[model samples]
Target: MKKILPAILLALLFILTASSVGYAADIQMKVDGVTILAEVKPEMKNNRMMVPLRVISENVGANVHWSGTEVALTKNDRKIVLTLNSDKAVFNGKTVLLDAKPYLKDNRLFVPLRFLAQSFGCTVNYSHTTVSVDTKPFYIDGVQVAAVQEEIQMTMGSIVDELQGHAYIETMYNLLMQNKGNEVEAPARISLNVHNRLPGDYDQVVQIDFVGENGDSITSFGLYAEVPSEGEDEGEPKVVIYAETEKRWYAFSSKASQEIWELNAIAGKNGFLTMISNTTP
Candidate 1:
C-alpha cells in the first residue's frame, strides 16, 4: 500500500493550508471522476481537509461503521480505526498519528481526507479547489462498473433513478452477489414482487442494471419473494433472485429478502412511483 502523503501532494497541501481554513464552499470533492453527493460538504480545518467519514470512505469502496466516538473503516485487506478528537489512528493494526484530529459537526464525524483515503490505496489530488480521489477501478464478476441504474418494474420497464458514485453503485451490486442461491431445476411458478403484477412479472420490484464505461448494461437482475406455500413452514427464505444474463436463480434468507424489499421500497419512494402515480394524475 502507498504511504498516506507524497511529496507533490504535500506541496499542494501547503498551498491549500495557506488559504482560509474554514468553510469548504470552494472545495469540491470527486472520487473516480464522479462528484460526491455528500450530505455535509467537505470542510477545511487546521490546515487539513475534513470530510464526512461515511461519505468519503464509501466513495472509495470502504465500509464505515460508527460506535460512539470511534469509527472503523475497512476495504479489501485494510482496516482503519479512528477516534473522535484524536490524532491517533490504527491502520491495519498499526498505530499512526494523524496530522489533525477528527471532530463531529452536525452529528457527523469528519476525518482528514488524505489519511483515510490513502489507507485504502487511493490517490488524492488537489487542483483548483477540487479534490480528485482515484481508486483502483472496482469490478464485479470481472466487468468494470461505471454506474448503477435503478428501474421501476411497472407495466413495462422504466428507469427511475441512477447513481454514478462508486459507493452507491457498489452497494447495489453486492446485494446481488452476496445472496447467490443453489442451482435448481428452474422453479415452476416464479412471481414478480410488485404492487401490480406485470403481464407475467412486469412489476418485479428489484430491477438493477450495472452499467459499464460504454453506457451498456454489463449485467441485470431481478428479485422476488418466494414465500412458503399455505401448508409449508420451514425451508428456503422468501427471496429468490434471478440473474437475467446468466439465467441463474438464487434463494436468499427471510432477513435478506426483507432487506431487499426495503431497499427497493426506498428507491421507489424516491422515484416516479411516489409522484407520477401516487399523487399526480
Candidate 2:
C-alpha cells in the first residue's frame, strides 16, 4: 500500500507539471503615453500571442502594403519591404539579410514587430502586466529615435496561473552608417543582463567593451542575445543591452565583449573603450 501510494503521488505531480504548459497573454496599444487593451489569440504552432497586424498598424498610423508573399510598410515616406521565405529584407533601397524571416500562418502574415518598428520609427515596451507599443516622438535616454529592440519572454500562459512552457526569445541587431557616412569601425562598450522572477538556467551575464576611431563611433552599437540553457525546459533568458544602436538584441552562445571583438577584429582597428564593468568573483 505504501509503495502504491508513492507511485500515485509521482504520477499526479507529473500531470500537474504537464498541464501548466499554457497561459493567457495580455496585449495593449500605445499611442503617445496612453495604453489600452488589444485583442489576443493563441498562436498554437509557435505558441506566441497572435496580435492583429491591421489594428496595430492602423493605431500607429502606418500604411501597410501587401503583394502576394511580400509586405511593405511605408511611414513618414520611409519604406521597408519584406518578402516571405526570403532571408533578405529591403529597406530604403538597400538589401540586407533579415535576422528573422516573415511568415504566413492561418492566412495572416506575421513578422517580428521589432524589425518593422525600428526600420520605420517606433518603439515596443513589455512589462509583467502589459505590452506597450508606442509610436509618437519616442526617445531613449534623450535620443529621439524610432523603434529599438530588446528581448523579453512572451509568457505562454497567464503569470497568475503559473504555467510552464518551453520557448525562447532570440534577437539580432545591425548598425549601418547613413549614406557614405564612414567605413570606419569603433570600439564599443556592451553589457547584457537577464531579469526573471524564477532562477534562469543560463544566468551568465557577460559584458564587452572596445575602442573606435572618430568615424567608428558613428557605426557602433550592441546586440543583446539570450538563449535557454540546454536541458532546462522551463528556463528562458530575458536580456537587455546597453550601448549605442537600434534595440533588437539576439540570443547566442558566444560571450559578450566590448566593441564586439569578433566583429571589430574582422574590420581591423578603428574603435576602443576606456572603462568596463570590473566586478570580481
Candidate 3:
C-alpha cells in the first residue's frame, strides 16, 4: 500500500506539469541577451513549441507584413511567406514545409520558432521555459559593427546619444554600406596654437563605434562636417568620415551625409533608444 501511494502521488505531479506546458505565461523569449516581455507567452501545440511570429521576427531585424491570412517576412534580401493553418512556407522564393501549422490564439499569430530563427541566419536554443535567439552581427568593409553613437552641438550645449536595437543599428549600417565614399587623406587636429579655425574644425558632427564582446571599441568612425578642406566642395562644407582602425579618411557621399544629418536631427528628441518591450529576467 505504501509503494502504491507513492506512485500515485508521482503520477499526479506529472499530470499537473503536463497540463501547464501547453500554455504557460512563465515561458520567456530572449534575443541577443535581452529578455522580451511579450503580451502572449509561448505555448506547446502538437508537441511543438510555438512563439508569437511577429514579436520574434521583428526583433531580429526582419520586416513583417501580412496580406489577409498570409504573412510575409523580409530581411537581408530573404523572404518568407506563411499561411494560417498551413504547414507550407515560402522561404527565399522556395516553398518549404514547416513542422507545425500556424494558428491564432488570443488574437496573436503563433508559429514554430525553429523555422523563424533559421530563415534569418540566427541560432536558437530552447531550454526549460526560455527560448534564446542569437543573431548575426553587422559588418562593413570586413569589419564587424558594434554600436552607433551620435553627438550634436546646439546653442545651449552638447547633446549626446547612444543607439541600440536592430532598427537603429542595422539601419545605420545599411546606409553606410549602400553609400561608399572616396578614400582621402586625414584631416588636421585641433590646437590653440593654430592661426585660425572654426568651431566645425574642432568638433565632429557624430561618431559610430564598433565594439566587441570585450567592451573595447574595435573601430570608430567619425563624421566631420565643419572641418576645413581644400576639396572643390569647400564652400558647401562636405562631411568627412575618418576610420580609426584604418587610420584613413573618406569623403562622405553627399546623399549619405544628408541622410546622416536627418538621422542626427532626431537623435536627441527622446534619446536614441529603440523599440524595447516589457523585459523579463
Candidate 4:
C-alpha cells in the first residue's frame, strides 16, 4: 500500500523541497493525436526530475502489474510485460535491453515515466506545479463499487425491555423525509445485554445516528435501556452499534461516557446508550 502523508503535510513538504530541486517542463504527446487529461505528481532529485511510472501508465488507459520482481503493462489491444533483476523489457512482442536498472527510493519504485507514457502512444506534460497525462479513457470499474477489505470486530448483546413481556425489541422506526435531501432520519434496533454492575434497580438509554460520506447527518434514533444494578460513574460498560449494509457506515457511541463519539464514519450510521444498574426486589 502506498503510504500517504496527510494532504496538508505532503503539500508543505513539496513546497519546501521544490527550490533546491530541478523541475520538469510540461510536455504532452498524443496517441493518434488525441488529447486526454491526467493528474501528475513529480519529484526533483540530484539535479534531475523523476516521475512515477505506474501513475503515467495507468493514467493512459493502461494497467500496470508488478510482483516485486517483474512489471507488466497491458491495455485493450496492446500488451507490454517485462522482468527485472536481469535488465530486460518486452513491448508488444519486441524485446529490448535497458541501459539502466530500475530502483526504489523511499519505498517508491522509480522508472522512466516518459518512456512508458510514449510507449503507449500517450503524452506526458509537467508544469512547476502539476503533471498531466493524456491518454484514451480506459474502461474499468468505478472506485465507488470496490469492496472494503478492512476487518472490524463488533460485540453484540441484548437486554429484555419489560417484565411479563410488556416490552420487546422495537422495530426499526422508518422516518421518511419529504425534501429528499442527502440527510434522512431513521430508527434503529439492536439487541443489548442488560446487567447491573452493582446491586440495585437501574435503567439505560441508547441513541443511534447516521453520518453520510459527505459528513452530513442522515438519520438518528434514541433508545431506552433498563437494567437492575447501580451505575458506575467511571468505566461504566456500554454497548455500541454497527450497521451491516452494502457501503454502509459503522456507527458508534457510549453510554458509559454519556457522550457519543463516531467510531467509523466510513461505514453506515450507528449509535449507543448508557446504562446504570437497576435494582428490583
Candidate 5:
C-alpha cells in the first residue's frame, strides 16, 4: 500500500505539470494596442500571469539588465530589481512583496505582468486569454527664441558671416535668405521642449514654425531627440523629425545635425521676434 501511494502521488504531479504547460501556451499579451509575439510565451503561476521580461520591457521602452539570478529594469526615474524565485522586489530602493515571484521558464526570465505594468505607471487589464496594457503619454514643456545677425563679406568676394549665437539662428537666416522677396513675412521660429515621461529616458522635441505676414502660422516641423539615462550604455540615441510639408519623417543619429537643429530652433524663435519688433510701431 505504501509503494502504491508513492506512485499515485507521482502521477498527480505529472498531470498538474502538464496542465500548467497547456495553460501557459494559451496566454497572450498586448501592449499599447500592439500584440506582443514573444519567443517565449507567457505563463500562469499561483493565479498570476508571468511574461517574458525582455519582450515586455523593450516594448514599454524600459532598459533591462540581468546579472546571475537577478534582473533589473529601469524606465525614466523608476528602477525595479527582482531575483529569481523571490517574492520580494526592490522598486526604487523600496522593498515590496510580489504576489508571484519571477521564475525561469524555458531558459527565459518571466515576471509578473500586472506588477511590472503598474510599477511603470501603466494600466493593465486581463481577459480570458489576453492581457492588455496602456500607458499615458508624457507631458512636454519648453522655451523658444528668435533673433538675427548681420552677414559679413571677406576679401576677394568671399562671403563670411559670423553665426552670432546659436546654429538655430543660422537656420533662421537661411530660411529668410530662401524667401528674400518676402522679408516682411514673420521669420521661422524655433523651440525646444522636454518630454517629461520616463525620467532617465526622456526626449527633447525641437520645432520650427513658419508664420505668415498676417500673424497666421504657415507650416510647422520638428524632431524628437531620445536621451538615455545615466549609467546606461544605449549606444547612440536617435532623432526623428517629421516634415509636414513633405509628409515624410526623417530619422538619424548624427550629433552634428542634432546640434544644428537645436541651435536653429532657438535662432528661428529669435528671428521671428526680431521681425515682429521691426514691424511694430
Candidate 6:
C-alpha cells in the first residue's frame, strides 16, 4: 500500500508541475511599450512573478554580472546583488529581504519581478497576466525633461555661433569642423548647461558641452543623416540622429525638418544674445 501511494503522489506532482510550465508560456511582459519575447517566459511562485534576469535587465539599460551563485546588476548609480535560492538581496550595499527569491530555471536565472523593477527605479503594473515596467526618469542637472521620440538637428555653423562666447564650445566646434566630412561622421553625445530663468523656454535653451569617448572634453553637435534600410533598393534612406543629454540618450530623427534652421536667443539688458544662431550656407 505504501509503494502504491508513493507512485500515485509522484504522478500527481508531475502533472501539477507540467500545468504550471504551460501557464508560464502565456504570461506577457512589456517594457517601455516594447514587448519582451523572453526565451524562458515568466512564471508565478507563491503569487509572485519571477522573470529571466538578464533578459529584462539589459532591456532596461542595466548591466548584469554573475559570480558563482551571486548576480549583480548595476544601472546608473544603483547596484543590486542577489544570491541563488536566497530571499535576501543587497541593493546599493544595503541588504533587503525578498518576497520571492531568485532561482535557476532551465539554465536561466529567474528573479522576482517586482523587486527587480523597483530596484532599477522603474514602476511596475500587473494585470490580466501581463506585466508592464516603466523605466525610471532620465534627468539633466536635476531638472526633468519631457521624453520625446525625435532628436534636434543643428549644423556645425549654427552650433558654433550660438555658443560663441564659450571657449569650450568654440574649441570643440573648431575641432569637429576641421575635417570636411567630420560633421557627417558619428555625432558626439553632449550635455547641456542652461543658465538664466525663462518660463516655457527651458527645454529649448542649453549650453552645449561635449565629451569624447576617452573622457576628454570635446565639442560636437548632432545632425540628421539618412541611411538606406537593409534590402531597400530605391526610395529615400531613413533619417536618423543621435543626441544625448545628462539624463537620457535619444537616437531619433524629425520628419518635419530634414534641413531646417531656427534662430534662438537669450534676453539680456543690452538686447539679445544669439543662442542657436546661424545654419549652413
Residue pairs with clashing backbones, model 6:
none
Residue-pair clashes per candidate, as listed?
Answer: 1, 35, 0, 30, 17, 0
Model 1 clash pairs are: 198-202
Tens digits of lDDT, candidate 5, 1-281: 99999999999999998987777788887765556656677777778888888766755556788898888999768999999999999999999999998988778888999899899888899887888777644211222222232222222222212222222233443443232221121212222233333433324343455433243434444445556566778766655555546565555344644455455343333222222212112
Name the TM-score of candidate 4: 0.33
Judge candidate 5 at residue 148 and give its lDDT: 32
Candidates 4 and 6 compared by lDDT, better number: 6
| TM-scores, all models, native as reference | 0.72, 0.38, 0.61, 0.33, 0.47, 0.47
- Where does candidate 2 stray beyond 4 Å? 1-21, 27-51, 138-281
Local lDDT at 91 for model 5: 98
Q: Which candidate is the best by lDDT?
A: 3
- Model 3, range 1-281, lDDT digits (tens) per residue? 99999999999999998778543657787776666656677777777879888666756767789999999989878898999999999998899999999999888899988888888888899888888878887655555655565555443444555665444467676666566578976666632223455544644665676554455676667777655554445555666787777788888776787776565443323234442222222
Q: Output the worst ten-in-a-row residue range by lDDT, candidate 2.
A: 161-170
Cα deviation in Å at residue 73, candidate 2?
0.9
Question: How well does candidate 2 score on lDDT at residue 149?
Answer: 20
Compare candidates 1 and 5 on TM-score and give the better one.
Answer: 1
| lDDT value, residue 93 of candidate 3 | 83
Tell me the deviation in Å of residue 144 in model 4. Answer: 24
Worst 10 residues of 1 by lDDT: 272-281
| Model 4: per-residue Cα lDDT over 1-281, one tens digit each | 24555777888888866744433434332222222232444554443345555444533445678776788888655677656544567888888775444556555565665566667766666554554445533211221111111211113333222100000011111111111123222224332333212333222343333333343434443432323234545354333232323223222233322322221120111111222223332
Query: Which has the better lDDT: candidate 4, or candidate 5?
Result: 5
lDDT of 6 by residue, 1-281 (tens): 99999999999999998987777668988765455655667888888899888666755656678898998888668899999999999999999999998888888888998888887777899877688887754333443322211123333323333221121122223332332231133424232322332222212222334433243433333443333334657353333323333232333333322212211121111111233334546
Candidate 3 has a TM-score of: 0.61
Instruction: Compute the lDDT of residue 42 as modeled in candidate 6.
Output: 80
